[model samples]
Target: MASQVPPQIFSRRRRIAGLRRARVRQAKRDAARYILDDMVEDVLDRLEFIRMSPTRVLVIGDWTGTLALSLRGGGSDVTEHDVATLDEEHPVESESYDLIVSLCSLDRVNDLPGALLHLRNALAEGGMMIASFLGAGSLVNLRRAMLAAEPDRPAARMHPLVDNQAASALMQRALFKRQVVDSRTLTASFGSLDRLVSDLRDQGLGSALANPPPALDKAAKARAGAAFLDTASDQGRVLEIFEILTLTGWKN
Candidate 1:
């Protein structure tokens, strides 16, 4: 039996380019890393509560390298890799890592189900995988703004994301034991839509569509900016919501 290939909705090259741009951008400016930070904290907290000390660990998307640094301090051999160029088909060494922690990357993968399977395969029996990424309810403000920009016809401004239910289904299909899927909401305030976009780019959250829509025209840009501002609260800031989905599973 031949394995089916996942649809090519996202372009890994585009995402890698965005990550490269973010690396340089971060060096120049102190960029917002809330999403990555939240994921790191969640992983750390989970490890603490579970009281699991994995010696062979793989850390992905630790852009600030802080997660890897902290894990290494615990006397673990950690293999770090940028999430941008990870090939879902061959994500990691098979049955090698005792623990795999990937942050803010799964949402952009073209073959999400396949990616989960590869992650499960990479784990030794009973080894655990912890992954967190932006989920379905993320970027409400941006989504509204984009919709207002093209009232008649909207462009593909963002990638479709999985919710907790879809994540749980994927875990089950991967045959991971003791699977758990959860979602957490985080809020961030921005004075302007432009600032929100800048923050997203800084965190390597740029669009990774295979054929991204062209840039909005001047009028559309103005409309979008205005629409985004209209949603600002009394505090003169727009509160954007990010729904982070976390998946925890152990290889059977």
Candidate 2:
């Protein structure tokens, strides 16, 4: 079947270079980049819990390439694929990989179910798939700010998030045995909204909607900043919530 997702949504042209630049900028600055690193660490921690020692592994959407590095460090054979190299219809040989880990990438796919099915097909029996992405309820504060900015007529400033329930069902639809879906909320406090946005850009978390809304006017931007500040806590910093959803399943 043809993919329902439009190829332009991800705009893979120079995507790898863009990700590399983002990580470089992140390292040069002391700003909070722990979200991406944290997500990778969390995936590793989960692997440790399962006591997984797979000889063949695949790391998808690893823009920073850290996950592949870590897996190779542990003496596992790892192949890295990112948005630049993968599409919904990418072919996979059955029972190819004993383990697959995807970080911060699946949510942007146009054909999520098809992608899941492909991943399931690529896994060996009892091989595990661990994927994480921003889910619904993420960027609540930012959404609110964007809404307040365009009070007259709201525009699409961000991509829609995948709900956890729907994600779990997708696992079943993909025929992943022992499927599980879970979420966690990570709150990031920023002194200003611009800093928050900068942090997002530094992590390659910018909007990837097919038809992104027009850039906000200067006045609207100011309004958003004010709205964000209005919600600041006693510590004088605004809080933004990032709902990280983790999907786990095994091919049995």
Candidate 3:
């Protein structure tokens, strides 16, 4: 006789789904410090072209708040919002900003194009938006490992990744003028798979596997652990990839 579907599987599925939603939400609020701090600082350093004395500025996402804090410290008027809070019915006031900065948060948005348009609408003519986010190429190794572990599993509901070309194309379609887009992959290493997974949780990257495979029994967990261990290098290190896309454009 065929074995019954394990109750644990359903439980795991529900847990994973909840985790995914939580992570997506967390990504908006918690703002990973190491990533946000570095990326925001870099964007600020490159803001020489943008007028320094803008009377009103909008910062979207937490990293944007970090940028706003810096700009305010330098004496710029700054207000902030979480992108998730913005929508058609409750739009940001029209033409309210001289500058808008969004950092490392757009990819989690359900409507990237719409958000760009809203950002454009919120800006005064000649205002600029500088945004950075993790694109399609992020997290290749973890994705591969997950697939390797469960080749028959169903596809993910949320986007687990984004690529550079796709991100650039989306920005182009948004009609921002003379858009500047650049992307680069940053690799972080972990001493073991467990630590790697832990770091992902800490960074709010665990949300992608919204419906991870059901919890394996002790034997299965051991087997998967062995498989990963076998694939590890002599130093027992595993690599996680973060592909960051940076873009700047003006609302003409």
Clash count of each predicted structure: 0, 0, 4
After superposing candidate 1 on the true structure, give the runs of residues whose Cα lies further than 4 Å from its correct spot: 1-3
What TM-score would candidate 2 get against the native? 0.91
Q: Please, what are the lDDT tens digits per residue for candidate 3 over residues 106-214?
A: 6655456666777777788878888877777776665555544545663442354456667667677877887888877778776655666555554544543333546
Can you list the residue pairs that collide in candidate 3? Answer: 135-162, 136-162, 136-163, 137-162
Q: Of the pair 1 and 2, which is ahead by TM-score? A: 1
Q: lDDT score of model 3?
A: 0.62
What is the per-residue lDDT of model 1 for residues 1-252, given as tens digits with 9 covering 90 to 100? 998777788888888898998888887657888788888988989999999889999887888888888889998899888755467556575568999998888888877877888988898878999989999999988999999999999998888999988999999998889999999999999999899999999989988899999999999998999999897889889999999999999986
TM-score list, all predictions = 0.96, 0.91, 0.74
Q: Ten-residue segment with the worst summed lDDT in candidate 2?
A: 6-15
Clashes of 3: 4
List the pairs of residues colliding in candidate 2: none
Task: Compute the lDDT for candidate 2.
Answer: 0.82
Tens-digit lDDT track of model 2 for 1-252 = 983554555544444555666767777657556677888989889889988888899888766678888888889999887776666446565467999888888887767888888988899888989999999988888888999999999987677789988998999999999999999989889999899988887887876666767899999999999998998889989878899999999998
Model 2 misplaced stretches (Cα beyond 4 Å): 1-21, 93-95
